[model samples]
Target: MARRALLSEAWWQQATIIPDNEREIAKHYTLDRSDLELIMRQNKAANRLGLACVLATLRYPGRPLADGEVLPAGVLRFLARQIGAPWESLQYYPLRDFWRDGKQMISA
Candidate 1:
């Protein structure tokens, strides 16, 4: 899915609520300090959500979720409700950028 299609006016509205401090959450999750800082820099909701998706996928010990792949309907609905985004829009929101950027910082 294209990045442009992923973002909508509703997506911005849903992301209005700034997430809790990433630093604290990172500590709780045992994420590396450097990686936590990188995540902190992504102030937008889409980017943050992408980061969350990456982290959530990492918790499972298997092939990670890939960009452009449709998430399970239930999981997508749950995330949409939690973040106040339109559920259908999530299908286009790929995690590639978030994962790549996150990996670069964490690996550096």
Candidate 2:
């Protein structure tokens, strides 16, 4: 049987992005110096970005990233700049979704 969604798409959309406020972005997405050091240890620009984004999602949303998740622009900018990466480098970070056994897979 196909799995069902636990929440409405509309609600998830709302939940995914911070409201583009500076204070809110800072509050939710700010990485500590320790986390920044850890993220920077990632080999590639994309890897650094991916790790930081995953941490941000877990910090604010209390969950790991979902497939095709769109983070807030301000939050993305915050994280990329904090990591010393070009904001557009995000294009190099691949989506985590994968196909397996005739189904789209999400990690538990």
For all candidates in order, the CA lDDT equals: 0.48, 0.79
Best candidate, TM-score = 2
> Model 1, stretches more than 4 Å misplaced?
1-41, 83-108
lDDT of 1 by residue, 1-108 (tens): 655566788975454322244453333334355645655575455654555456544652223555455445555444445444566644434543444534642321
Residue 99 local lDDT, model 2: 34
For model 2, how does the per-residue alpha-carbon lDDT over 1-108 read when each residue is reduced to its tens digit?
A: 999999999998788654578888888888998999899887678779888988988888778766776887788888998899877877766633443454768653
How far residue 78's Cα lies from its native spot in candidate 1, in Å, is 1.9
Top lDDT prediction, candidate number: 2
Ten residues in sequence with the least summed lDDT for candidate 1: 16-25
